[model samples]
Target: MAKRDLRALMQPAAAGMFMKQFLRWALVCCAGVFLAYTLSALKVNKAPSDPWAAHCLSQFLSDARSFSTATSDLKTTVNDLSAGDTASLTHARQALLRCRLSYKKIEYFMEYFFAYPVNLYNRAPVHEIEEPYMEYQSPVGLQLIEDLLYGEDPFAQKQALQEQAAVVQSTAADIPASVYGFEATGVQVAESLSQELIRVMALGIAGYDAPVCKSGLPESAVALQSVKAVLAAKTAGEQNLYADSCMHYLDKAIVLLQASTGFDTFDRLSLLTDALLPAQEYLNRYCCQQYPGIGGEGAYNYNARHLFRPDALRQAAFDRLAQSDTAAGLVALGKLLFSDNRLSGDNTRSCATCHKPSLYFSDGLKGSPTIGNGGSTRRNAPSLLYSSYQYGQFLDARDASLEKQIYTVLQNPDEMHSRLDDVVRKLDNKTYRPLLRKAFSQAGKQITPAMIARAIAAYERSLSPFNSAFDRYINGDHNAMNVSQRRGFNLFMGKALCGTCHFAPLFNGTLPPLFNRTELEVLGTPDGGSLDKPVPDTDSGRFGIFPIEFYQYAFKTPTVRNAGETAPYMHNGSFTTLEDLIEFYNRGGGAGIGLEVPTQTLSPRKLNLSQAEIADLKSFMLALKDSL
Candidate 1:
């Protein structure tokens, strides 16, 4: 081809390249236009750069912690703020004006809900949400909770259910979860205890005391002496030999319990009703002969519960759980998570450390020490055995339910001083998701404090060790206790007024549902004297919650069962022995004030126990104890 023809071909190729470049530039321009439009839709204009607003937001979070024991100011600020301090709450005042996060607000009130269920049940003061603006007007947080909890709208129901999750999460949110509330060992321990409780309750009536029983002797002195002689034996072998040797003679005892065959002339029913100690002894022997593992199956001891109410629940919840692999899987997964200390920020503790199963799921301490520098609080660490049955918690009766109680302890600086932020981070851990997914059959929305609380609560209810000698005695065991224990029981009910606080069966500080220890009372307890004028732990009692003079120096009343093992009694480990406590009660509690009076009509009159009577009372309390 000629030079002109070659230039023409090259010119066409050059033209195509120019067109391609033009189209590419046009497309780029269109894309930029679309991006600009999208950005504008978000209304991304920066707020009139208010340095004050920015400073306020920063200051608000710095000063306001969402922890339950939050300072009044901080508490006020968080409730009013809608956005997190990092978000729209651009000023301290703004953040302190409106609560934005639904979860945070719900949790804040949930703490109150569990703390005062009856109070809320009767009158849920809707204005509390206005706490941030208590002095002002708009009731934002309170309205939100009220709308959800008591609202009829579909949206409200949905919100209420979702709120439960937040409620559970709220407790441990402050927990770093380095080791499952590692930020606060007490929280971890309480959570651990909660888990144990849930697990125990699932056993259902399996561990509950049956009403059938044993009845042994009418003559209190003879029965008491006989039982004491057996007890005084140096070894388990000796006790057993005496029991077994007497088995032939026990025909009279057995007849006394089951029937009045030989005692036809006596009031057999009355004799049976009066034989607490003899009943305890008979049950103990029977229990030793029947089941092992009572006191570790050693010849050292025999738990009498087996004879009367052995695994007596009419319906075991675990039976339902065991029926399906899914439920079992969930429980197993929960058990693992419950035991995993890795949930802690530092892997230093788990739910099991303080709520060890071996210890009947209670810390073997007068009072659990604080996980932080704040130090431990007053009260003996109550056993977590019948926690599910508890109507109120702590020796001070501060918390109401297991879930809320668990949360309170979680947030307590002396307890679980853990940060919820840390817990969420760990619960959201990528590695654990698969296990959680398999366990719950659904990978839940990252582990929240609410989820942890509920899970632990479910687990804690399972720790009940039902069917003790005392229970058998109540059911039908006449020989469950000696004559002294029987008389003591009589005094406990008729004279001591113990049944008024600690109900039957579980012996927790409640008479079923609405009847609870939520009511405040001042025992006028003698101030535990120290080298210092005012002891460091002088409990102002419920007065700390409200400054009423009448609400002075009062604490919670724990269950009387298991009193033998859980020592160092009272609010601040004040009394060293049960005898001392008895004496304190006999003298009345306000001795220091020269009153030593019981504030309640139920008590306050001195126990007025004579020396012999004190021994009898002690023996009766002894009936409440049993192996875990």
Candidate 2:
């Protein structure tokens, strides 16, 4: 009876087990169906037919058509204008204004790809610098024509105006073909838009472009319209909410520009704070969310909260110099070698002899004295605070690499006067061997001159500091700069021409977008700042090494970062005070003092800065005192 009961219980248990298996299979099938549905939904919602690039191309073509037509009309108007003036000059001005509007439609796009040509066609005539290879140029573009055509002597400038119109027409004709072949990514477009917007806000609204014409207000409206079109094209279809947000801010900016009146009377601060800044902020937000890898460049970055950040630039510079080694070890070994006197011929002096860290890495002397005995060096010992960021080393830019610069200085009779072989032999001795082992490990086992040079280079690369009050102001701390400093900043970027050479952020010669190469200038520095009896300094400069006519009297543009601390300015230490140095630049260097420099790269025209303006500029330079 007991066995039969047990068998009966087993039968019910088997049936329960089958039921459980059936429920498990049914639940799995339902989950698979739900997953498929979710994936299908995502595919439908995320996909858009006309992507950002497609919309951009379509808008570009339309803008090209408008530009071509406008140029043709302007050309006809110019041809009709004569001395008697068959058509009123006012009508011609209207036509010119229309043409500018059409061009503004694709301004940033063209400027980004064909910057060289665009600059040639549209650059202001102020403080134009000549290069070694290029021919001398006068102001020959739209701004020059604007000045002449809208001046008191429009009738007198009829022929010149007509010629300028023809040049502009040809340039406009080339835009379509140039734009069609060019390739660009969405991030690059954003960068160009942001930069051009800055130019538009800072220069355009200030009547810099339409100085004599007083068409800044209208021209700004048209420029804003072009920006609007670009934003519209990029954010064409659904599934781009971030771009839509960008479009909203851009639309508001256009409205602000359209409503603004009086070129000289318009509130520039309002436009900057309200319209431009908001649009820029939104665009930056979109870019960071969409493409985190792509970055905004030197003058501005939508990704960056402020206009300037030196830490990022310094890191970028360091990345280029040291590719393999740990920065910590390399810097440590470099610091040790920097102070060690064993590298010298008599083992009595080292790099620290001239470059003292306490004095902003400068020797505080007019010229670098000899290491062994006391003798004078021809050139001043430039502070090495940020020397590693420069491409060419030394006052003449003779050494292409920092390592080579060390070697050159070491062997120079007036400097360290040590042989590389001798230095390497000394470094391999008991005192330095252990430190080398800690820095380079296996590579340090057999010491060489190159290794020592690299260690020193690494330390030099770590020296540039960008945390200054001016930097803070540009980086979004409005309170950092006082009113005078702000005015000085404007003058620096505008009439002063200091920014034309010592570029912002780095405040050096490293060009933007690709901050790899450096530029040299022939400033025609005088032997003394005495206006009563000025004489041109006779230094062969870069020509000594290159032996080229153009390179004569050319020296590297040094960083103006620590101008407050590093004194006895210029290659020869001619100016003893900052005020005197400013005066020298204000008078347009040696050429302005009646010295003949045939290949003088610096413009030989006085800046004519007022006393207040001079004080303001000085204030700005002082603000660059490194916080670090």
Candidate 3:
């Protein structure tokens, strides 16, 4: 152990430590350089600054904060209702109404951008059936709370009401995070405004959301005000004529809403045609001018002038074979096949057998007779007119597409009783082979059942003529619909709540401005249209398909168009006369007549339509009959 040996060992250790420190310093410098380069690249690739979008985002955040605060207040008020008196209940309802007003202000953006969270805030107060998997989602949100508070005994369901309010409050708190960094463009703003206008007309004025409170008019006015505010924010310093026009119409609409006497007496037709439609047109035009060749996603055609226009919706959006070029030829072939009995098992029945051309594609019978038997089909034959425009087919909505519906009918024991494969083989004749080849020239030589379905569907799609008197009237021919018809149209769209489910101008279950899902409602239709002794129809309807308790007696809302020609109404064809059908609705479906329908989606409240109003409604429906 010499002093020189100890010094040598320390020197080697010091040299190793120095080398490690130098390497660490070099790595840090490299990391700094890389980080600087990455930052520079990010800056270069960043989207250009949009002042309009920035302003909207700022406004959205502010509105979202207000909504959150209002919901918190509502939650607090609801909590107090448990131990408080009638005054406390009144205060809770008032707080709920305040929350609704605040939510309405931001509903357009929230619904368009954040649909999932919006469901928790204000979905239809019914058990929603999640498709394919058939998951039953229990109803939550504002609508449910409204139903509870407005019920006969709100105190009895205090626990349920408070829970729903909490859901709304919690969902509201996440609004800012849900919309963080959401880039709002002129196209989106325009589309969202147009959609809001449609919502206000179809659902709002019809009292779809305000089921019990009947505060749709005031709520709609607030919504329009919010829309006006957003438009002003976008066109803050711009010299746009369309923006000015849009604002003018929006103001008129808000005024009309505010001036409304009551839900049943609101001049919804005037507001729709004079104010909302004009506002929608100008807003769409403004968006088009601002962002040319740009369109938002969905079933709506942004380029269309108004909702009532024949081309307002992208019809092809619902069809699977939208891009097919042989539509004309397919329609012709389908027409022949539709009437040909060779596709049926007994060669005695055809699609045309039940769907008669003279009756507007519906048989005049209560229910079409079954093939080769003394029985009848399970449900009444719905008119083929405008059937292709909807997302769901059949009264029960078991089939998702027209093709599937056709196939099901063909194979059903009581209907065609012929397999699709059999039908394809039956169509191998010289008359059909050539037509099939010409229609499906793109496909291989062999014909398939799907080809048959597609051909038939093509013909069905062509069935939408949009040439009814109502259609003509909406398309600028004011003389088409008479005064009574016009008045009826107003009632149908507003007080009667027909437009809420049977949305215009299709007057079917297909929802707009995104006509993606078809709605099924439980009207609690009776087995027979007897006002004295009403009995709920035993038909399981949608429950047969989904097996959910809420789906019991749920049936697809069929189109009311051409009802004058297509006589027997309801899935069972129980009501023979239009008057009886109207009476049934006036009495509030089956529930109003004392039927116990626990899952009835239709409101049990009576419509209380007058005799004159009923006549007007009938007149409007008659006007819907196509010239064809």
Candidate 4:
């Protein structure tokens, strides 16, 4: 009996000890797991030093030396050339090409560090006739000399050519000197390389830069060589596999250019898609792998499979703006404010009057009727649909932000003709006050102009629903487009050169990867569709705001996403039908239509598209209509 009692007592004591031991072990395991997680996170956050930046810097200096030498040779060639002599002129042309080749090799460096000076030396004199905003300036660059040399009377402009050559030499010499003053970073090199490739594909291949000479092919070859040089620099002090991948493609591009019979025969689209873009993608991947978070906030990764995407619009917005308010509440508030005529001075009209949802958010008029019987607006009322995807607002690109653009429309005498204070007072009613409170629920508790603008802008943004048939086709539904539409797509990207300006997907000039920058073109539109005796549109466009010669008559390129639906096209709403609008572009704007638009940015050559081809093109445009 005594032995049994002792055993029971021992069992209880042992059980208590075992429970304490198990708890102690669990605590130890948890502490070990926490320590490991902390260490792993620290390792992941650490970034490595980039070796490509230093390498690219050294290579740029070498390129600068070559460029300087070429420019000096060009100057000598120009000086030695005799007036009215064929051989001398031929030699001069060759010399000019040699200089251009050297320039093309280092075009990235010039475009990056010395954009202003480089413009002075190499800017194309396509339609540079007059600029009332600046001093009466004449076109003075390589293109200026090209016109003189290729003209019927080359000798007559000998002195002028010599002067221009001197300017070019001075510009080239300054570039090398400037290179030493600046420092290079890995992110900058990656960004510059991507931009350079895009320039090559867009401007260079389209013969925009070297129009007179048609030297795009050979110049592009030299540019590819420069790209190789850049890649070689990047490969230094790093793994060869990634850099070599890009180099292989670049080598293929150079070979393809070499094999090309002529400019007309060369497939620019193939080169862009197969070679250049892939190279850019690999380079981007390598950079990201080597140095995380190097390009700074909102900077493009450059590794996107496609050139453009609709979501890029939101990504480009500031983090604060993107996360500011609930989309549903803001959109609801915006919709109410847009239709409320009380926002105007006389309660006669609202945003809905001009931008009716029935007409794809356009007024469907040549020019929108004046807000208070003031006649009509000077320009066409551009469709609000998909406008939120653009980098800038207004034909003149006066407002860089959509929210800021609201003020101009509200206050314009011929539009809303209302002050912000008046609008705010009207909106400070029971209907709007609570809606505004719900929409904001934070900082915009009180109805101010900014809150009104933000709410309206939010509704405008909601207009871009991206449910077009083309979107479906690109997103894997091959049956979305007909054969004619497919052919038109090829022609648009290839022969028509529409993609050069109105970029793919969004079909606007907001450049891709990060669609933050807007581009303007000087199309030289006629006054009133008078092709027989076409008169230049009186509007000074971008020049009126910036007062710069380069910006003379420059208007922001609008999106052609719903061009089929939005009638009365162009900034002025001159064309009445799609055929008329297509014909204008086919004839290459005013210049091709027999107008002496010296500063016309559009290619002044006829597209020579047959009726059938035009029909196909129209079909493609029609396919861009949104599901809404």
Candidate 5:
């Protein structure tokens, strides 16, 4: 009887259970219909404003990796070809050149991904420029960024990266090299490895503040961090502004790499090697782009995104200690002293008074502060535009180092009329030293004049005289210069015979970096200073520094880096206009001004410059301000 009763109850329950299953299936089906409808609605609504925006971006990233890999493979192949002692290397070099052209176009697409369409009237605003930069990312950098941006697992992605690296390592063995390009040439692989490590670490340490990405459910977290960073930039420090996204990516990349396969010397060095330019270009473009409402480099109104990477603590510490720590405070103090008029006895001038920042830090005066003209200096004030890159110091090359040069100018009776002792006394009592002391804590009590000059010089040195239209032309910019600038540049190197003195790359007195001092020559300048009657200085030029006749009249070559700005022209500021200067050069040096030096190569060299040629020369000089 008990069993029969249980069966009766079970029969009713079984019927109820079957009905419940049918209802549950129906509900799930309904949810699927709702989800499909919602997604279709969103697609219709949003896709118009962003037509192919998502596709464009995804396609772009995909192409980026493909292009980078393709170029790498091409480069390796070309290099491998060059290794063979071919009957003619022309084919290999030609192929290499062709491949480079393609690679560069890819670089262009990467660099100006968001380049606004060019308008004929779209004159580049004050200094807004979208220049080309190489486009490539290290395997680690690429993988880490992917994981952060696309919700991929970092460790798994890193494992895939290690396998790719192993392939690259094997491929590298089969490749050959030229001294001019490629990251790791065969002979100095060891040194290359060391450099790569430092580079990777700089990149790695910088990644700490990026948005977090994981394979799990916190989809809103990255958006949240980026949003907060954008907001906080209003009151946050510059370091924070630059570091927030870009740095975070690097940190995560570094962490993932370490966990996947521990870094050896090669991995560390290689990352940095491949990364330096990309890191700088990305940060520079991102950090400096205008934010409309904000005044500083990193304005609060704009937003940009980058993926995250975690940097291990050890890596971070290593980079921080190894990197140069010339702080912003130092740059600020240097700018202050450089422009301070109070440093002079007459209180009439400052370094900036002579070196106008807008005019490429050159007054564009033939010479500055004309004592006789009741104007300032007579000769053109050569633009210090790239003066930091100048080897040897000063117009006459009287000083060897920046240390001594600052002292000379300060003590010179005509220029500034204040001694180093006086400068120290004036600044000693001022309230700037404490901040400096806090900065250079190690040099607490020892910070002195040399340090001050170096700091200023360092700021000056940072003024890299690159990015000129001429440089762009040389660096393969087909449309960089207009026909006039292009023609003028050609004339300068050839018929103008300017390269006889000013060389390429640095385009200064020497082919060397400013760090390695080299002296150069100009014919002579008119003896038209305070001495009404001429007393011959015998072109004693840098001979003031090295008491040698051969060195006489041999002044350090003023970097054409920014000669476009500094003017009056020459050591004594004889020429008034760039036109006059060009004419004088065409006629050949000081001869037109009654001072003649037969040995002056520039002297009366048949520049054969017509009125048009003269105009072209000036046009070329003006074009040089691209460094601005």
Candidate 6:
């Protein structure tokens, strides 16, 4: 300030300056310490390099590049098809096959990691109606191209084919950016391989994508080879027995698929039982050995040995509520309620009246008699076997779960003709009260509609007894299925295209690997089994529920597991015998029989199955009957 009256002011000013200098030095030191700490933390938190991620990224990029190139070539070839010449058509077809092969090589990763984008690359050829929004997405990608090129007039569809090929090439070009930073762990790679195997079995062999081209067998071989390559990359230099066994089985399967005589003649049963199943078992074991504490994060149970193993799928993953130890008690109570006629309005009919236990839970009638005998029920009663595994229930797939399905049936006027509350009240007597109390002890002496529904659903869920001859055959009893049954199984899975909708293991509408959705198809079933005078069934089926145009007359694909005992097939119960039913499908549903079924999803082309083949198919279905 002032010179402090000479010496005093000078001393005060000098001391203040020294204090300021000390503070500056302290601030600089603190900043230096903070910077060092930040650097140390950054180094500590840095992720370790993942060899699996590196290998997967490399393979994905390589395949993506090949796919992009193939699709570009496909587009050019398809454009040339506008000339409408035989040579142009042949070149286009060959280019399309090459494009498909390239796509299959990378399908596992694309489907596993990027489902939404991949849809544009290989969705079903049909126009898909997105529910709620009702957005109709016209078919695009390889399937549509395959259909167009193989249709009766490929020349007429040249422009459309060219557009689809362009879409596919554009989608392929974006693949690398879409998976730019994807880090694949060993467990995920293993899980992807397992899921790919299911896809190959269910969709690949069944000609799901190559419906017209009949290139499914070769595509499946390429897909399997890609899986083998991934497995080898992961287990490189490892001498584990499980790894060796997995490789051996995969090699055997690849060889078998490559040497296939034709799609219809391929021994699918042997390939499945002897190669795919065994390979899955060994691969699962190897994964467990390598990554002991890791677990899968989807519907599939990565720890399971094979697809047919009881624990292969996490069943609880599909359930709306988590299952508990009380399920056993709930199942017992449900069984009692399922048979009690008192639950019906008139107390004269029960679930067993329609779904009789003696006939594999299906009444041996064209359609079961209505609750009070006015007219027959609209649809035939479907068997309760394996009903719980599906995402939707009933012929129309109107119900999302077994519990909801039971509730609807209890309240339907044409069925039980009773409300859930009425059923609960009827079951409050000594015969059911104690059982209900034990099953739902946490509810504290209250009997509710939900409890009844849960109990009945639990009982239905308990009916999935995978102990049929087919199950035994797949699980290592080579003699369980006879030669006729084996041939039939192959026909059903391969030539018949049954496995695409009625997926294996469960043999129902539920899609596997990711058991997230149930599919419905418009088969255009006739009103009666008269092929000469075929008429489309009046029942609207799934269209009654969703009201989507494409879903007109669509119905859930019922399991053929116990077709032997559950006669009178289809929603209308129009076909009275297995032979007649096979004949109907052989002739190609209603459309093929000259019925006006505009939305018929079933191919109108004849199956041309021999009588012996039909007999074999029946035998295979009969073999699906459980040992109940």
Where is model 3 poorest over a 10-residue stretch in terms of lDDT? 1-10
Each prediction's TM-score versus the true structure? 0.46, 0.74, 0.88, 0.77, 0.45, 0.89
TM-score of 6: 0.89
State residue 565's C-alpha deviation in candidate 5, in Å: 2.4
Which residue pairs of candidate 6 clash? 4-9
Is candidate 1 or 2 superior in TM-score?
Answer: 2
> Which lDDT tens digits does candidate 1 get at residues 1-628?
0000011112455335434633553465356446655655665534223332233223222322442223233233334334223342233223222221222222222222233321211111111111112221111122223323222332323333233223322322322111121121222222222222111111111111100010112222222232333223322444455344434333444344344332112232233234432443454554445333333311112343221243322112212222233344455555666676654545566666666666655666666665645366565566666655444566655665566866776555665565766765677666556655555556565556665555566566565665556666766777887888876765554344343344444454443212222233445555462212323345677657645433456555566777766666666666667777777656544532254332221233354578876786788788887666
Cα lDDT tens digits, model 5, 581-611, are: 6666665554334454432323332346778
Better of 4 and 6 by lDDT: 6
> How far does residue 18 in candidate 1 sit from its true spot (Å)?
99
**Model 1: residue 273 alpha-carbon error in angstroms:** 5.2
The digit string of per-residue lDDT tens for model 2 on 1-628 reads: 0000011112455335423533453464356446646655555422113366556656766887888788778767767776766466777878878877777777776777666656535655322334434432334456655655655567776766776676667656655444433356777766667666655754565454554565666776777777767766666555566666656766777777687655433544445555566666666677777678556334234456423445334344424455454644788889889998988999988898888887778877788888667778878888887786667889887787778889998898889989999999888877777777667766436887888998998788768777788766665687987887777766665555566567655777765434556778777788865754788888979888777655678889888887888888899888887778878778877777777665566655576888887897788888888854
Model 4 residue 628 CA deviation in Å? 4.3
Candidate 4 per-residue C-alpha lDDT over 1-628 given as tens digits, one digit per residue, 9 for 90 to 100: 0000011112445335423533453464356446655556555422224566656666766777787888788788788888667788888899889888888887876676556666556755432323223333334567766766765577776776786787777656655444433556676776677667666665666554565566777888888788778867767666667678878888988888778776544665457557866776676666667666644555343445434334423533432353454555898888888998987788999998888888888888878878767698888888888776665688887876668888988998888899999999988988888878777775456678998998988888778777777776665566887888776665665456676577655677765434556667877788887666777788888888987654677888888888888897888887887777777878877767876554466666576777887887788889889866
- Selected candidate, larger lDDT, 2 vs 3: 3
Assess the local accuracy of residue 559 in candidate 6 as a C-alpha lDDT between 0 and 100: 84
Deviation of model 5 at 392, angstroms: 0.3
lDDT of 3 at 49: 57
lDDT of each: 0.41, 0.67, 0.78, 0.69, 0.41, 0.78
Per-residue lDDT, model 5, residue 366, is 51
- Stretches of candidate 4 off by over 4 Å are 1-51, 80-87, 126-138, 151-153, 236-244, 297-303, 311-328, 346-348, 372-374, 385-392, 429-431, 462-522, 533-554, 585-588, 591-628
Q: Which scores higher on lDDT, 2 or 4?
A: 4
Candidate 4 TM-score to native: 0.77
Lowest summed lDDT over 10 consecutive residues: which window, candidate 2? Answer: 1-10
Residue 494's lDDT within candidate 6 is 79
Q: What C-alpha lDDT, on a 0 to 100 scale, does residue 298 get in candidate 4?
A: 52
